[model samples]
Target: MPSMRTRPSRIVLIALLVVAALVLVAVVAVSAPILLHRSAGGSGQEIPASAVPETTARGADGRVRTLSAHDGDGPADLGAVAPGETLRIDGSGFDAGIGIYVAVCAIPASSEEKPGPCLGGIPEGAESGTVDESRLTSAWVTNDWAWRSFATHQYSDASEGSFSVTLTMPEPASTGLDCRETRCAIATRADHTAGSDRVQDMLLPAVYE
Candidate 1:
C-alpha cells in the first residue's frame, strides 16, 4: 500500500507534466500560424517598378499636382480616372490624422447622379508612421470585397500627417481593367491623425503588370 503522501507527490508530478505539455502545445499553436502566414506571402512581395499612368491634378487655381498611388512601385500602373469611382491614396507629405470615418464618392463627369460623400469606418488594422516632412510615400486600397489592390504609393510625407494636396480618380486605369464607381480613401490629418477624403485616382492590380 502506498502512503497518502507518496500518492500526493505522484499526483503533483502528473499535474506538472500536464502543464508542461500544454505549454509546449500552446507555443506551437501560436507560432505555427505566424510561420505559415509569412510563408504564404503575408504582405511583403517583390513588386517590380513599372510605368504607371499618373493623373495630373489641377486645383481650381490651376496648380498642377500628381495624385499619389495606394502602393508605390508595384507592378500595376495608374492609368485613366473615371467618374463616381474612389481614388485610394498613399503618400508621404500628407497628414494621416483620422479619427472615426473616411469615405467618399466621385461620379464621372458624364453621369447624371451627383457624387455623394460618405464616411469611411476606421480601417481594421490601423497603424501610424513618422511625421517628418522629408519622407513622401504610402498607398491606397479599395474596401470592396474583391480585395482589389488599387493605387500604390499615391501619397505620403515624412511629417506623418499633412493633407496638402488632393487627387481625383481618372476614367481609365493604366491596367485597362474596367473600374467600379466607388473608391476608398486614407489620409493623414494635419496633426498626423488618420482621415479619409473624397479623392480621384485609379490603381491597377500588380498581377496585371
Candidate 2:
C-alpha cells in the first residue's frame, strides 16, 4: 500500500543501515586482535614476568641499514624469531648476583621513519610528544649503557652463566604494530655491577618458528 515516493525512501533507509553495519564490522575486525593483545599485567599494574612482553625502514644512503642483535657477543647470540614465537635468552655474560630488567621492544613493519619503541597502550596523541612511560604498557626499552634509566620492573637473579630469560614474542596482530617492524630484546642489570651497567640488546628479524 506504499506509494512510489515512500518506496524509494524505505529503500534508502535500508541501504543506509546495511552500510552502517558493514562499516561497524570492518572496524571490529581490525580492532579485535589489538583489543585482546595480552600484556604481562593489566593497566597501571606492574607486569614483571620474569616475563612478557617491526620492520624495516632505511637510511638516506639508498642502502637499507638493518639492526639485528647487537649483543657484544656475536650474531648467534640473538637468533631470529617469528610472531608468537618464544625467544630464549642464553644469559651467558649478562649479570649475576643482582636483579635485572628484561623486555622486548618492537617496531612495526609498516613504519617509514626510524623505528622506535613499540609504545602501545599510550594515550592517543602521546607518540608525538613524551607520553609518560609509566602510562605506556608497551614501550620497548633499549638495553644500552643507560638502559636502567628507563626500566620499571626489575627481575632478580638474572642469568650470569646458565640462567636464561625466556619470553614469547608478541604476535604482530596482537601488538597492533605493523607486521614488518623490527623487534629488539633488551636486558640490563637492575643495579650497577662490576662497575658497568652490563646491558644486553638484540634485534630480532622475522623467521617464524
Candidate 3:
C-alpha cells in the first residue's frame, strides 16, 4: 500500500538502522575484552609482602635495568607467584629515549631467543589515551610522540626511565605453556616501535603454583 516516494524513504531508514546496529556490534566487540580485564581485579592495590627480590639485566650500552615483583601487600618472590593473583612490577635504570613493553612471557630456550607469546596480549587502551588500571596485564612505556600524544597518561617514568606497573597472573593454559611445569618470566623488550632492538630486553624468572 505504500507509494514509491514512501517506499524509498523506508528503505533508506532501514539501511541507516542496519548501519547503526553494525557500528554498535563493532563497539561491543572491541569493548568486551577490556571490560573483562578490568573486572578481573588487581589494579592499584598494594602488593602483599615486606621483601621481594630484584632481578637485573645489562643492556648492550652497558646500562643496567631491573625488575621487581610485589603481591597485594608487599614485595614478593618471582619464583612463587600464585596463578590468577595480581603482581606489581617495578623497573629502573632503563633508557628513557626508547619505548618498551613489559609483559609476562615464556622463557626462551636461550638468551638469544626472544620472549613471547606474552600473556594478556597488548592492551587496546594503549592505542587510545585512556588506560584502565584494573586491566593492566601488559604495559607500554615510552616518551615518543605517539605515547605523549595518546598514552601519556597511562604509564611513564622519571627522567631516569624508572617505572612501575601491575598485572594479573595469567593461567598456565592461557600462556600455552604450563608455567607450573616449565619456567616463565616477567620480561621487558623494545616495543613495536623498535621491535628488533634488544638493548632493553630483560627477564625476571618466574614460576606459578
Candidate 4:
C-alpha cells in the first residue's frame, strides 16, 4: 500500500542496515581470536628483586633484562632444577618490539657466544597443545605481524615488554647439551625474525639433576 517512491527508499534503508551488520560481523570475526589469545594465559606474579640467583643482563641498548623462575608454588633456585618439572619463568625489561625465544640451552662458553641448540627447538604456536613441544619453550613476538595474526596465546605484554612462560624442564640429554658436563641455562635471545641480534640475549643458569 506504499507509494513506489517510498518503497525504493525503504529498500535502500534496509540494504544499508544489512551492509552495516555484515561489517560488524567481519570485525568481530577478526578481533575475537586476538582478544581471546591475549586473555588465555595466567599473568604470573612479579619476581622480587632480592630473590637469590636471579639473573640480569644489560643489552647494548642499555635495557636491563631480568629472568627468574618459580617451581610449583615455591621460588626455584636457578642454580638447581629437576629435570622434567614445570618451571614458570618471568622476564621483564625486554624490547617488546623485538621478538624473543625462551628455552633451556647450553650456557655459552664466552660472553660473545650465542646460546643454543636449546631444548624443544622453536615453538610453532602460542597456545598449549597446538605445538607438541611448546611445553619446553615459548616465543613472544607480538611485534611480528604474522605471529600476531596467527598465534592464539599472547605470552607477552606488548606495551611493557614483559612475559611469563611455563616451561617443562627437559632432560639434559634431550637438549643436545651435556648439562652434567657443561653448564645449562634458561636463556632468551632475539627470535628468528631478528636472528642475528643479540641485544636481547640473557640467561638464568640452571643445573639439572
Which candidate number has the best TM-score?
A: 3
TM-score list, all predictions = 0.25, 0.29, 0.67, 0.65
- The per-model lDDT (C-alpha) reads 0.30, 0.35, 0.66, 0.65
On residues 1-209, what C-alpha lDDT tens digit does candidate 4 reach at each position?
Answer: 88889998999999999999999998776555444432111112222233244666555666777777888777787666777788888888777766677788776655555677787655655444365434655444445554555432344676667888778876676635677787777777766555656677777777776
Worst 10 residues of 1 by lDDT: 38-47
Report the poorest 10 consecutive residues by lDDT, candidate 3: 38-47
- Order by TM-score, highest first: 3, 4, 2, 1
For residue 82, model 2's alpha carbon misses the true position, in angstroms, by 2.8
TM-score of 2: 0.29
Clashing pairs for model 4 are none
Q: Alpha carbon lDDT of residue 52, candidate 2?
A: 29
Report the C-alpha lDDT of model 3 over 42-62, residue by residue, as the tens digit: 111122222235666555566
Steric clash count of candidate 3: 11
When sorted by lDDT, best at the front, the candidate numbers are 3, 4, 2, 1
lDDT of 1 at 190: 14
